[model samples]
Target: LLWSSGDESRGAEQALFQTVAPFQTQVSEIERSRRMRGKRQNLA
Candidate 1:
């Protein structure tokens, strides 16, 4: 019973990670791109 509960918790953790990880990565990339564009604009 304990083992089954642990497996369920693990699955939920993995699902949460899967949902949020991509958004985190996408947000980081967007911020980086915005910074690069700002720098280029400053140079020009």
Candidate 2:
């Protein structure tokens, strides 16, 4: 009973993470590009 509930929650958590993972990568990429742009401006 309790074990099954735990498994169910774990599966939900994994599903949520799977959905979020791509957005996280996109955010990191955006941050990286912003930093690069800042550096280029500083150099100029």
TM-score top scorer: 2
Query: Which TM-score value belongs to model 2?
Result: 0.94
Error of 2 at 29 (Å): 0.4
Q: Name the weakest run of 10 consecutive residues (lDDT summed) in model 2.
A: 1-10
lDDT of each: 1.00, 1.00
How close is every model to the real structure, measured as TM-score? 0.83, 0.94
Question: How many residue pairs of model 1 clash at the backbone?
Answer: 0
Tens digits of lDDT, candidate 1, 1-44: 99999999999999999999999999999999999999999999
lDDT of the structure predicted as candidate 2: 1.00
lDDT of 2 at 2: 100
Model 2 off-target regions past 4 Å?
none
Candidate 2 lDDT over 1-44, as tens digits, reads 99999999999999999999999999999999999999999999
Clashing residue pairs in candidate 1 (N, C-alpha, C atoms within 3 angstroms) = none
